[model samples]
Every structure is written in C-alpha cells, then in structure tokens.
Target: MIPAKADIEAAYARVKPYVHRTPVLTSSLINKHINAEVFFKCENFQKMGAFKMRGAVNAILQLSEEERKAGVVTHSSGNFAQAVALAARTLGVQAYIVMPSNAPGVKKEAVKGYGGIITESLPSLEDRERAAVEIKRETGATFLHPSNQMEVILGNATATLELLESHPDLDTVITPVGGGGLLAGTALAVHYFGNRCMTIAGEPFAADDAYRSFHAGQIETNTTAITIADGLRTQLGSVNFPIIKELVTDILRVEEAEIVDSMRYLWERLKIVIEPSSAVPFAALLRHKEQFRNKKIGILLSGGNVSLSQLPF
Candidate 1:
C-alpha cells in the first residue's frame, strides 16, 4: 500500500533526531540564469553526504528488536550502501552491504568506515540481488530493498516535506529520478501538503527508464545506463513506479554534456559540490528555461559523494 502524508510525518518525527534537516540554499546567479527564484534543498550536506540516510534510518527504526538483532542487508552502488551502514551503526544493528565491484573506491571506503560488512558483486542488478540474498541466507539478516520499501519512500518524502514547509509558495519541485524513491516521495508530499505545487523529475537521457516508464504506464528498463549520473543508473521498481506516474507532472531527460555543464555551474556558481545526479534537475530547468520563467522552484540536490580523482569536468 502507498504510504500517506501521515506516514511521512511519522517518519520525519521518527528520524528527526537521527537525520540532518539539511538547509535550503538559494543561488542568485542560478536564479538570474533561469529567470526564476530557485531553492536548492541541499541533501548533499545530509548525513552520509546524501539523502539516502533518511530512508536508511527510517527503515532501520521500523525493525523489531529481534529483526534488529538479526540485522539488515541491502545491495546498492554507493549512496544507499553508506546510508544503510551508517544508519545501522547508529542504531546498534549490524549491516551487510552488497556493492558492485566497480563502485567508486571512496564509497566503498565510506561503507567500511561505517562498520558495514561488504560483499562485492558484479555490476549487474541481478548479481547484486543474488549476493544480497546469499548474505541474508548466511547471516539471517533481513533484506531491505534500498528504494522500494514503504518506510524508505516515506522517509525520502520527508526531505521534500521539509522543503515545502519552509517554502510554501514554490510553484514546482524537481528531483533526479533513479530508482524513483525520492521522486515518488516528493510527489506524495506535494500531493498532500503543498500549495498547488507540481512535482517533476529530471533524468539522464542515457538512463531514461523513469522517463519512459512515466509515459508507458508501467515500469521500464534501460539495457545499459551509461550516464555520468551513476546514482541514477538503476531502473524504477514497482513500488515507486505507480506513485511517480500518478503524481509527477513529467520526467525531463537531459544529455550527458548538459549534466556535466550543470554540475560545473553549481560547483562554480553556487560554490557547493554536487554530484552529476543532483545536477540533472538543474540541467532540465536550463534546457526548458522558457517554461519556468519567474516561478519559484525547489530543486533537491541529491548527493555529494563524488570521486575527486576522477572529476568529470
């Protein structure tokens, strides 16, 4: 069942002590460029340096004492891995993370630093799932689907809820679509509490399953998501797809070069470090600037977990 606005509020209260209430930042330069007043909800400054921490904490808090003792397991490429690890550690629960062998070294190190037991898998979704299952079997850990669980979705919605609460007059809110947890949650928050605000998603053209899924009225997949927005490489799961389809106004697709340009602009203009996935929404706004002129917009900056050694710019 889809979680309601009350569920998101409960989650916010549950996780409020654990997660950071990240600030909403404004960029006058960016506003000038888009001709709109834009508020950036800086989840890049969140715990574990990503918005994933909110969901991780909420899911962990939902576990029973026995389940907490048995621990939790999930497969993720980066941000969610660190989130689960950190959340579990904070709650005195064990965490097993199945990460792609090709995941960025910095992310892997962060997971390990958070006391996660790491099991490496091939960079395929199938392999990661298989490895997570094996870990659950071996350790009796409860498996958590990183983005598809109700608790996770509602937890993610709190970020948008906080944004809208602070900026009640925003005309629109945008977030990058990966597995669609954040977008689905944002849509729900806007539906329940916003002042006639619309929810939209920005996604990579190279990994555009969410965009396609929005139109197809069902989940979609990309054979290979070769985008620099690594956090957005995964396909939307069943749990998030329906919510996204029903509430999101549209999914805007941006090219890779545009992603890089937007990332650079945020770094240089706003003086804030944001990953490529975070840049997708801003890139989409830049691509369709005419549509949002003079409107107040909120953009969720999803993460800052980038590898300095391999800077895309």
Candidate 2:
C-alpha cells in the first residue's frame, strides 16, 4: 500500500535532523507572464544541491543496525548519486555508487567528495542496475532504489510538505517527473496537506516516458534518453506509479529548446542557477499557461548540479 498521511508526517519529523527545510520563493515576473502566482520550492539550494537528499537521508535512517553496517548502494545519473553519497557519509555508512559514465563530471566529483565508492557503467539503465546488483551481492549491502523505494518516496514528500506549509493557497503543483518518485511524493503531499491543490509533472519530450505512461494508463520505457535534462532520463517504476496515476492531474512535456531556454530564462530572472531538469516544469507551465490561468502554482526546482564545462548555454 502507498504511505498514509501519518507516515508522511512521521517521515518529515524523522528527516528534520538530517535535511534542510528549503525555502519556497516566488517571482512576480514569472507570475505576470503566466497570469498566475508561482512559488518555486528551491530544492536547488538543498544540501548536495537537490531534493534527493531528503529521500536518501530518510532511506538510510530507517535501516537496521546490521543493514547500516553492511553499507548502502544505489545507481543514479546525477542528483540521487550525490544525495545518497552525502547522506551515507552524514550517517557514517559506506556508499557504493554505480553511475553512468556520461553523467556530469561535477556530479561524479561530488559523489567521490562524499566518499562514495564509484563503479562506472555504460550510459544505460540496464548497465547501471547490473552494476548496483553486483555490488549489493558482493558486499551484502542494502540496495536503495533511487526513485522506486517507498521510504524514498515518503522522504521526497517532505519538500512539498514544507512548500504547502509556506504557501497553503497554491491551486496547482508542478513537478519534473523522473521515475515518478518526486511526482508521486508531491501528489501525496498535496493530498494530505494542500487545500485541494492538484499535481502535474513536466517532462522532456525526448524522454517522455512519464507523459506517455500517464496517458497510456501503463508503464512505458524510453529506448533513447537524449535530452539535456540529464537528471530526468530514468523510467517510471511500480512503487510510485500508482500514486502518480491516481492523484496527479496531468503530465506536461516540453522540447529540448524549451528546456534550455527556460533554464536560462529563470537563471536571468531569479538570478539563481538551476539545471535543465529544473527548467522543464517552468517551460511546461509557460507552454500551457492558459490551463492554469488565475491559479497559484508551485514548481519544484529539482537540482542545480551542472557541469561548468557542459553548460548548455
């Protein structure tokens, strides 16, 4: 079963000692352009530069003494990799990370900085998973799914929980969907905390598995992950999909150009750095601006871990 409201509340309390209560910021210019008030949950300012820290911390905190002794392992392209590594380090647990070779060098460096033992894999979901499984089997470490684990989902919800606490009047929440962890968790947060707020997801058109999965009423896989939003390349998983399919209002997708332009657009206006993945939701909001007319919107700026050399600008 999906996590109940009490479960999410408890997770928030459990994570407080480990994570930051990130601020929810608003831009009047963005509101003017979209014809609606918008609140940006600045998880980009989060520790390790992403919301994945919340989940990774929660997932590790709940582990038994024996599990912690064996350490933790996961496979992620960027944000979650850094999150897991940092969380494990914070808790004095060994972290075995399987990362795709094509992941940003900055992220790879961050993982190493957090003391994660890295096993490089070819840039594919299969290779990443295989490497993680091998490490888990070899070291007897507990494997934490970057997005599919229930503990991770509940941990992810704390971001939106904090958002609704700051701005309770929001009518809609927009999340960038990658494997549905944050989207599913955000939907649950709105369901439990918001005053009838609806949840939507923004995805890259090139890696539109979540968008396709939402409409098709089933899980879909992307054969090719060629988008600039490197963080959102993963596919939806069984654990988060049910909550997403039921509670999320829609999945809005944008093209590569929109993603890059919106990334820079917010950078210029908000004067804050956000990755291309963070810009997807803003692009979708502007693309479908008419749908949210007069609505108060909440967008989660997922992360800010970009390689300086690989700036898409």
Candidate 3:
C-alpha cells in the first residue's frame, strides 16, 4: 500500500535520530553545462554509504520486540546488506545476510564489520533470495526484502522528503531506478511535498526493466544485468510498481559509457566521490538537457561505496 503523507512525515521523524541529514549540494559548472539549477542530495555520504540505511533502519525498528529478538534477514548484492547489518547491530538485533558470492568485496567486508552473519549464494537474485529464505527458516529471523516492503518504501521516501523540504520549488527530481523503491518513494514525496515538481528515473540500458515496465505498464525482469551501476540492477517490486506507474513522470535510459562519463564528471566537477550507480540520473539529465532547460532540478546522488581499486576509469 502507498504510504500516506503523514506516514512519510512520521518516517522522517523516526529515522531522524539514526540517519544523517545528507547535504543538498549544487555545482555551478554542472548548472552551466545543463542550463539548469541542479541540487544534488548527496546520499553517498549517508550512513552505510547509501540511502538504504533509511529503509533498513525503519523496517527493523518497526518489527515487534518478539520479531527483533528473532532477528532479521535480507538478500542483497551490496548496500542493503551493509545497511541491515549495521542497523541491526546498532539496534541490538542479530542480522543474517545472504549475499551473492560475486558481490563487491568492499560491501561484503562492511557487512562483516557490522557483525552480520554472512551466507554466500550464487550471483543471481533468485539464488540470493533462496539463500535468505533458508537462513530465515533456520534462524527464525524476519525477511526484509530490500525494496518491496511497505515500511521500507516509507523509509526511502525520507531522503526525497528532506530534498523537498530544502527546495520546495524544484521543478523536477530524478533518481536511478533499480528495484523501484527509491523512485517510488521519490514520486510519492513529490506528489505530497513538491509544488508541482515532477519525478523522473534514470536507468541503465543494460538493465532497463524499469523503463520497459513503465512503458509496457507491467513489472518486467532483466535476464542479465551488466552495468557498472551495481546498485541499480534490481527489478521493480510489486509493492512499489503501482506507485511508480501512477506517479512517475518518465523513465529515461542511458548507455554504459554515458553512465561512466557522468560518474567521472561528478567526480571531477562536484569533487565528491560517488559510486557509478549514483551517476545514472545525472547522465539522464545531461542526455535530455533540452527537457530541463533552465529548470530547478534535484538529483539524489545515491551512494559512494565503490572500491577504489576497481574503478572503470
């Protein structure tokens, strides 16, 4: 179910103590090049190096005392794995994470650092979910899907809620659509918070299910996700798809090279270290510059958990 406006506000309040109020930033150079005033909500600096922390914390905190005692479990390729681990540790609950064997070493290490018991699975979403189900059955831990749960969606909205609070007049907001959680939350936030501000999602051409889903008016899954933006690889969820189809203004696709160039541009120009997934929306904005001409737009720089050793550049 879609969260009410009050639920989004309450979510902000609930996660406020646990999460960082990430800064809203801008680049004069980016503005000149795109001919639009762009505000970068730097969630790369968020706790766990991503916005997933907001959802992770909110979902875990909503569990009953009995549920928390049994602990929580999730499947993720990276950021959400670290988020649940760290949030569970901070809240004094055990977390068991089923992570793909091929997940980035940096993220796997972070999950361990946060005291999550790790289960290795094959490098497919299906395998990851299966492993998580096994862990949940064995440990009696609650399963927290990274993007589908309603509580998680409400939590993800807080990031854009903060963005809208800071810039109430934003003409549009863009997010990289992976599992559709963030984009759904952003759309809901814009609907309830913004003054006619629209929502758009940037997606990789390689894993463009969200794009196809939006146009085809149904949920679509990718057989193979081969993009450098690791975080933007998951398919849309049932819980968020209805919200997205109704509220999102458009979905734009960008090539892999464009994703890389946009990432490098942010690195050099914004002088902020952002992961490739964080740059997809920026690439979309630049690619469709004519649409945003002179408008005030906001882009959420999603995360910064890249391993410097493996950068494409």
Candidate 4:
C-alpha cells in the first residue's frame, strides 16, 4: 500500500539529519526553451549519489533495536544498494546487498566500499528477490524493499516536501519513475500540501511500466531491454501502482537517444552530472515542449552516480 501522510511525515523526521537538502536550481536558458520557469531539485548532490539515502536511512533507522542488531539486506542496481549500505554503516548495522551481474563496476565497488556484503544475480527483480530470500534464509537479516515498502515510500517523500517548500510557486512537478517510489512519494506530498501543482512522471519508452499501468488502471509488468537508463529498468511495484495511477497527472515517455542527449546537456549546460535515469525527465521536456509551455515546472534530478568516463553519450 502507498504510505499514509503521517507515515511520510514521520519518515521526513527520521531522515532529516542524514540526507542532504539538495539545492534547487533554475535556468533562464531552459525557461526560454520550455516557456516555463524550471526549478531542479538536484538529487545528484544527494548522499550516495541519489535520493535513495533518505528512504534507506528512514527504513533502516526505524528497525527495532533487535532488528538492527540482526542486520538488514536489500537489492539494487546501484544507488539503493549504496544508500542502504551507507545507512546501515551509519547505524552500525550490517547490510547484505544483492546486485545484478550487469551492474556498473563503480556501483559494485561503491557497495563494497561501504562495507556491504555483496551477492550477484541476473538482471531481474525475480532473480534479485530469489537471491535476497536465499541470503535472508542463510543470514537471518531483515530485507528492505527497493521501492515497495512503506518506509521506502515515506523516505522518498521527503524530497517532494523539500521541493514544494522551496518553490511555493511551482505549478507542476516532473520526476522520472522506475519502481515509482519517488513518484508515489511526490504525489502524496503534493496532495498533502494542497498545492495545485500538476505532477507529471517521465520514463523511458523502453521501460514504461508505470505509464502503461497508469493508463490501464492496473499494474503491468514486462521485461524489455532497450534503454540506457539503467536505474529506470524496473516495473512498478504493486504498492506503487495505485498511488501513481491516482495521483500523477501525466506520464511522458522519452526515447533512449534523448536520454543520452539530455545527460550530456545537464553536464555541459547545467554543470550537473546526472545519470541517464535522471536525464529521462529532461528528455520528456524536449519531446513535449508545448505541454509544459508557460508554467513553472519542478524537475527532480534523481541521481548523479555515474563515472565520468562511462557516459554513453
């Protein structure tokens, strides 16, 4: 289930001190093209190179003293694993992270560098889940879902709260969706603030489960590999499906090439290094320029966890 307002609020408090209050940036050049005042909540500056830290810290900290002592486990392509490992380290708890065989070397090294126990699996949630289960059975560690858990969603909401609070005049908020925790949390936060901001979600055309599910009025899962946005490869979770369907005003699909181009643009023009996943939203802006014309838009740059030389563009 989507986290309640209280739960999200509690998570905000729980992770307040641990996560970075990433800055909001604006560009007149971008505004001229989109015909909107664009504010970016750059999560690239976030700890562990993404906003994942907020949720990881909140969920890990909320564990019972016994549970913390027992330790925690999770799976991720990159950012969430690093977030969990860093959070667990902060709390003096052990963490086991299952990552895919195709995960970037930088991310794998980061997970290990943070002192996480690493397990490799096929590049699918089913494989990751199976590995996580096996690890749990062997180690007796609590598992933290990358996106499905309430604590995760709640922790994700803190970014939205910060965005809205920082930009009271924002009329729309755009975020790239993967498993939908960020979008779900953004939706809940926008609703609670009673603000009229339209929440628009972006995803790569190659992997747009959240978009399909929103349009179909049901969760949809599929495996298609066609995007460079590795962080956005996952389909929506059952818990995140309904929240996104009800709350997001629009779901925009961006092409893979555009994702790469936008990543380059962010680095060259904005002087911000964003991952392909974070660049998807900017790609959406280029594809549907008219839709966002003449409005104040907020875009969440979800992460900056890419090696400088490994950029696909």
**Scored by Cα lDDT, where does model 4 land?**
0.87
Residue-wise C-alpha lDDT for candidate 2, range 1-313, written one tens digit per residue: 6678999999999999988898888888888988999999999999999999999999999999999999999999989999999999999999999999998999999999999999999998889999999999999999999999999999999999999999999999999998889998999999999998999999999999999999999999999989999989999999999999899999998999999999999999999989999999999998999999999999999999987787889
Report every candidate's CA lDDT: 0.93, 0.94, 0.94, 0.87
TM-score of each: 0.99, 0.99, 0.99, 0.97
| Tens digit of per-residue lDDT, candidate 4, span 141-192 | 9999988877888898899899988887788888999988888888888877
Candidate 2 ranges beyond 4 A from true positions = none
Writing each residue's lDDT as its tens digit, candidate 3 over 1-313 gives 6668999998888899999999999888889999999999999999999999999999998999999999999999899999999999999999999989889999999999999999999988889988888888898999998998888888999999999999999999999999988999899999999999999999999999999999999998999999999988799988999999999999999999999999999999989999999999999999999999989999999899999999989
lDDT of 1: 0.93
- Cα shift from native, residue 257, model 2 (Å): 0.5
lDDT of 2 at 108: 92
Candidate 3 clash pair list = none
Could you tell me the TM-score of candidate 4?
Answer: 0.97
